[model samples]
Target: MADKCHMCLLGLIILCPLLTGMNGAETTHVFCSSGENVHLPCNIALSGCTSTTWNYNRHSSAVEMVSGGKKKNDIERHERLSLGSDCSLNIKNTKEDYGSYSCIQYVNGQQQGTDAHVHLHVLHGQCFCKSHV
Candidate 1:
């Protein structure tokens, strides 16, 4: 019984930080196929995306994809990106879109709350075809 309790406590200590950011924001994992469209949720309730900003990072410096609910025209993949009604970041025809995305909300030029982090994992799907002889 003591061993089980200790193991549980150890697990919590090891996993808690990974589950939540330092600011106590929960991280969500989104998995999608390589060539499919994907939605990275903001997980925040808001009337509009006017105060939302989405940043993406893939093993390097973060890039701002959307600012104040508007897509950044200068971004590399801006053509394939759109902001959903619910402030979710939508990426169309996702091929190399796997990365860490963060949604931040600001009001009056100040951050409102904790940022929502999302880790996107893109999997290469395989097709199996059978021949009828």
Candidate 2:
């Protein structure tokens, strides 16, 4: 009985740090209006964007927007996409850009850290008209 209790206590101590580190990787929410420009932030900050990659997922499939610090021109919305100096993914005139954006970092062709997730919510503006008699 004594040996079992000792092993359980040791296991908790070793797993505590690993569980705490998982909290650092969290999802961020960004809200924007239609026809407006928006930037999705990356949680991890590195020296340069040479190892950064951005992907967008609207419903099922994910499309790569920026890879290796360069924008992919073959994408549908390539003209409206740009990468910021700090590895952020920027979109111009966001109309159908409401989706999930992920920022991943790599080094030496291998992924370095966990992916940073950003959820974009697009809100359309409404107009209210009043009539006076």
Candidate 3:
């Protein structure tokens, strides 16, 4: 009985930090559009990220990104800018592609954060330059 109790306690001790995720980096939604271009931003909670992945499932492949700087890799090879702690994704213009987006991060060694999901809503309109009357 004592051996079993000790084993259980040991298991908990080994798994506590991994589950708690000590000061891990985080990915949050900045702003995203439907018909227009969408931008996704991410902020690092901690500076212990050896590496990470910026995931947009709708896109063909996942982006292997390194922490400590800005990221600007769009879905369709856009030449815009993604900026720091801000991983933006532009969907161009589409109604069928209006859905959710995620930027899953594999921090430290274990899969810690994967819950940042952005929803898309398509719109139709035209904006022309206008001067004050």
Candidate 4:
């Protein structure tokens, strides 16, 4: 009996860190051309998400992109904005859309939350001023 208890304690000690690591927020960088479409991954596997929002540094605050199974008015909203069933955000890439974004996940009747951080970089054309000799 003592040996079984000892083994259980050892198992907890080894798995504690791994379990905690699963809850950590993941950060990723995405680069897209100024006139293309780019998809930002969010809740790829989480279910029962009561609400979800996407916050961008370019905006004043978090915008309710998806709520109550619908999309709300957001400052970042564009004609090509698309929300996937998995909660991924698809945006028509533009220079104005280049910024750090956070996908917030909310569960019903829960206070704690999880999120994914993404940094968007828009590739734009370069112009050079040339002077003829």
Candidate 5:
């Protein structure tokens, strides 16, 4: 019985930090309309990041959007993809851009901050017109 108790304690010690780290990360969502610019706020300052990456679609092949200062590279780079002064992601609104976007921040290439998960929901647009009788 004592041996089993010791093993359990050891297991908890090993796993405690892992669990805490995962809990430290956060996930949030945002909604946007098609044909409008959307800001997925990370709220982490640019000065705080040595590296920053945005990932799209949590389950599918994760598409990475890179940005740091004026340097950015990725498919969405041409479409006015930008990071705000506060490190929020600004995406030129489109139906294709609707999905889960995750912002992972790093200091000196070590993940050490709250992660952001922004869900971009693009509402289907409609036009209303009055009938002239």
Candidate 6:
């Protein structure tokens, strides 16, 4: 009976948003078979939050994708990765697009919350190669 209840709870967790609204977690992960999808979690005080932005630094062959937005000044990285307002780092499928990522959140023109960390790991191709051996 306990195991059944635990499973029910897990189901609820995955289905609650579908039944209710588009709610998101304070933290999330993005798994990639060939690439990585990064979700940078951030928050600011409700009283002072006006605008929010994301900043990330990527060095794949020692390159910059995003330095900083118009509001802030920072170094830029390579073009292999893309970023969005939700703080989503969308990287194109590339073997070299794997490394440490620094995620920053800005609110009301002030840095707040924390600097999130994300790491990308590249894996071998399909396991079919092993089967042939």
On TM-score, the candidate that comes out on top is 1
Winner by lDDT between candidate 4 and candidate 3 = 4
Looking at model 2, the pairs that clash are none
Steric clash pairs (candidate 5)? none
Clashing pairs in 4: none
RMSD of each: 10.9, 16.3, 18.0, 17.4, 16.5, 12.3
- Which should have the higher TM-score, number 4 or number 6? 4
lDDT of each: 0.77, 0.74, 0.39, 0.58, 0.59, 0.41
Give the range where candidate 2 is weakest over 10 consecutive residues by summed lDDT. Answer: 124-133
Among all windows of ten consecutive residues in candidate 5, which has the lowest summed lDDT? 124-133
- TM-score of each model, paired residue for residue: 0.76, 0.74, 0.39, 0.60, 0.63, 0.43
lDDT of 4 by residue, 37-125 (tens): 77877744366434666666655554555654345665446466767778777786455677767777656645235667766656454
- lDDT of candidate 5 over 13-108, digit per residue (tens): 455445433445544545444667777777555574447777777457787775543335547554578777777777774556777777777766
Sequence-dependent TM-score of model 3: 0.39
lDDT for model 2, please. Answer: 0.74
Displacement of residue 58 (Cα, Å) in model 6 is: 8.6
* Native-referenced Cα lDDT, model 3: 0.39
User: Which residue segments of model 4 deviate by more than 4 Å?
Assistant: 1-25, 48-50, 59-62, 74-76, 109-113, 126-133
lDDT of 5 at 114: 68
Angstrom error of the Cα, residue 64, model 6: value is: 5.2
Q: Which ten-residue region of model 3 has the weakest summed lDDT?
A: 124-133
Worst 10 residues of 1 by lDDT: 124-133
Regions of candidate 5 where Cα sits further than 4 Å from its true position: 1-26, 46-50, 67-72, 126-133
> Highest lDDT among the candidates is held by which one?
1
Candidate 5 lands at a TM-score of 0.63
Q: Between candidates 4 and 5, which one is better according to TM-score?
A: 5
